[model samples]
Target chain A: MVSAQPAGFGHDTRHELIRFENVSKTFELSDRTVRAVENVNLSVARGEFVVLVGPSGCGKSTLLNMAAGLFHPTSGEVYYNGSLVDGYNLKTGYMTQNDHLLPWRDVVGNISTPLEIRGLARGTREARVEQLIDLVGLQGFERSYPSQLSGGMRKRTALARLLAYDPETLLLDEPFAALDAQLRLNMQIELLRISRSLNKTILFVTHDLDEAVALSDRSVVFSPRPGHIRHIADTPLPRDRNLTTLRHDPLYTRMTAELWDLIMPTLQETRGEAS
Target chain B: MTNAEIGYAPASDEKVAEDRKRRMDKARQARTRERVKLNLIRLLMIGGFFALWEFASGRLIAPFFISAPSAIFRRLGGWIWSGDIFYHMGITATEACAGLLLGSVFGIVVGTILGRRPFLARLLDPIITTFYSLPKVALAPLFILWIGIGMDMKITFTAAIVFFLVFLNTYTGVRNVSRELISILYLMGANEMQVLRRVVLPSAITWVFAGLRISVPYSLIGAIVGELMASNKGLGALLVRAQGEFDTAGVFAALVAIMVLAVIFNTAVRLLERRLMPWKSAEQELEGAV
Candidate 1:
């Protein structure tokens, strides 16, 4: 198998950008305790696009939250760039299912939040914001509030806001699941383009097998509740790929089918439990 | 040539334009007729109310006790002509405004603090509720004893009344802020103060405005009750004095003045809300459409 390595890459051994060392998280509910994730060990390489796929309530989001330092693992530690993460992982940008855009702020204002927090100069911030607006195709909506934008447009604005901080790593949680199919495809393509150009390390969580196969260099499948890594598979598809024509690729089809096979039992188990 | 070829057939574009115009005209006429009917009914209802009040005053009810609408109007006119009504109005307005400003500031500050700190909010919940349950009017006599029978007593009473209402609403508003948004802000490297200013305050502002709207009338009620209990100034004092002298018309006139004051305060608060939250109007319109 030919290893698809871009030029001027693959020599550095310090590729571990984010690492979870025997991490586990448990939530204490009012009446009982729920073990969300159990003894999960995962590592994301620098500039690697990794996707986490699992059934509902599988602690996929919990794993990402641990990486972002929003939630501390109960027993073990999460490390970023070889440093223990005690508080918020400032080097990473996190996006959840909800856009979480400030409704009071206009598009530019929302996108410029991180810059303002960092106390960037007015001219520089405005210039960067304008560039992002163009990049996200939200040029004419600079002054429109979140309520005024369409669902797809709001998601784009959120992406722009996430990028504004220029974090080295991104933690995205089903960011495109709320969008319709066409819009979702468009966003996925845009995300891939941006991720490549920026060369960001991404740990994305999604329930869609096709999305995972299409976007990631390595896809991690998680088991249902008390989530553990069930399988970690490397995509055979080349890095230079077109998202629109991805499904037609034989290799892409096989990868998605394999993922579906791996996740179907857990999905059925959940259905069984519900019934 | 056939008749169709000789241009005797109706022109399609002209006919369509004429039909559209006729439909629009009919719609406009119907709207105008409906509006006229509505206004006529409203006027008749108001006229009928006054006529009945006049008819019942001296026959079914005693004029000396209930007083006639004409007599109340005459008393009001006399006060206005003498310019004594303005003095009473000025005093009441001052007390209410002072109390509202002070109460709102205190409420927002304390409410925000308590809202941000769940432990503190929970700790004080029982005590706060106990105080909140106490009728604010009952405090008027206590305020008079402490502050003495002047504008200070009325202002203090009004502030106490307005404070509790505003505080509860602001607290709920802050608590109800979106957890997702707060988490996002924290991930963005915002400290506690930044999160409060940039996210929490803005998110809770609508609830704060709602509280402000509700507190305006309560502020007036507090001031008037304080004055009625014991004061030498304000419209409430005037009403008390009129009752003592058996001037039923003067008492009715004072009540009318208080109603006008409520309307004015409500209008001012609405204007302030519009100015502060321009985004809320768009949000409301979206909600209305949905």
Candidate 2:
């Protein structure tokens, strides 16, 4: 029944921001079909930081796409704010793996793109873009093109651009996958800071175990291939989280090991099936 | 609000910055000197070629068969002195300009439309390829027959040639546009028209400029070919008349004029390219390429 929602069977429907109604997506190719995700029943409550953790090819990104209204479930429905998401959802901002920053645009221009698209006044757009640039610490790099920016700087610019339109929710799909370890760690810290300051609902997708455990209020662990929500575990880490120090915390280490235990079997099963 | 709030790169050794500037200056000066030397060598090579041609025209070969550069220069001078070249050049330039504008618009539009519709493009690909393969010059006679041997025929023929050159370039541009970029914008609640303007147009314009660079010269050539095939007013007609009279120098002079026309068209396109795609750094552009 529609009332029987995951983690919220008795809770009021008003608090639920997004709900997946028995969602399944089967992508048909010329010769075969790829069942990307199956029977994905989930509910993201308002202001909840839900991180989807899975191995590559697990359709974690597809779930994010479904939430953003880029794709519809082949079998079921995706409801956002009590309405079916039939088209591109305006309430969410998606930061894809690729920065997707317009190469022709400088830092300022790329940050101001969403505002410009929304047809905001020139002065208002400029003021907002300036504020975002400052927020993301891209002050001196305003004139620099994406090509001229460092990898870390480019990711920061993307973060600012995502914040430019001021969406209520953020769907970040493998946003820091390409960054080096140090940069990735720094961005993870930056994301936590930004997400806290803005209090935005974030549906973060990453394969990285540490990232999932470090950032999420509730970490949704997924199995390989046809992605199934294997475990929905609460992170229960302190709100004032410093990742550098938190990585060594007793709870952080234990959560990560538990997540790996849940994930390790799927990897072995995939290998078994392949062989 | 303050820089101290975020991680800083720290002062990157002022001496390193100064040294970098100095090396850049030296490199620029070295490049300037090399260019000067290159120009000097080119001048010598051209002068030697002319000297050989001048001597050989009368001594080793018949001046009738191979007109001297001096004779071509005289013919050009005569055209310049009489101001008769203005008449022919003005017509040719007009045809080329008209053709460029009309063809570029059609090319950009058709190419962009095709780019957005994958199935429609796939259905039309075979016919489109066939048309693209059809040599544009082969259409001159048909265009002349249909439109008649006037400015109309020349302009139409020129536009036909330009369309293909620009069409493929823009189509390729549209194809290469990042789909993820469009998806990102769509997620931001940008409409189809806004996506077209913000993502598609900017991505395709770079290719349009490339197409224009290649198309500008062809546009002029198309006009000239049309004129040569029929028309009695343009510079192509002048070349034909010279050939009829066995005026080798006149033929050479006409060719020289066409080269000059091509240079002018290319320079104009370059200027326009500078204006439209200012994001493309001039230093990143090929130093002396068309």
Task: Report the lDDT tens digits of candidate 1 across residue range A74-182.
Answer: 9988888989998788888888888889999999999999999888999999999999987776766788778767777788899999999988999999999998786
Docking class of 1: acceptable
Task: Please give the fraction of native interface contacts (Cα pairs under 8 Å between A and B) kept by each candidate.
Answer: 0.53, 0.53
Q: What would the TM-scores of all predictions be?
A: 0.89, 0.89
Docking class of 2: acceptable
What DockQ, between 0 and 1, does each candidate earn?
Answer: 0.25, 0.39
Residue B237 Cα positional deviation in candidate 1, in Å, after optimal superposition? 1.3
The list of candidate 1 runs beyond 4 A from truth reads A1-13, B1-44
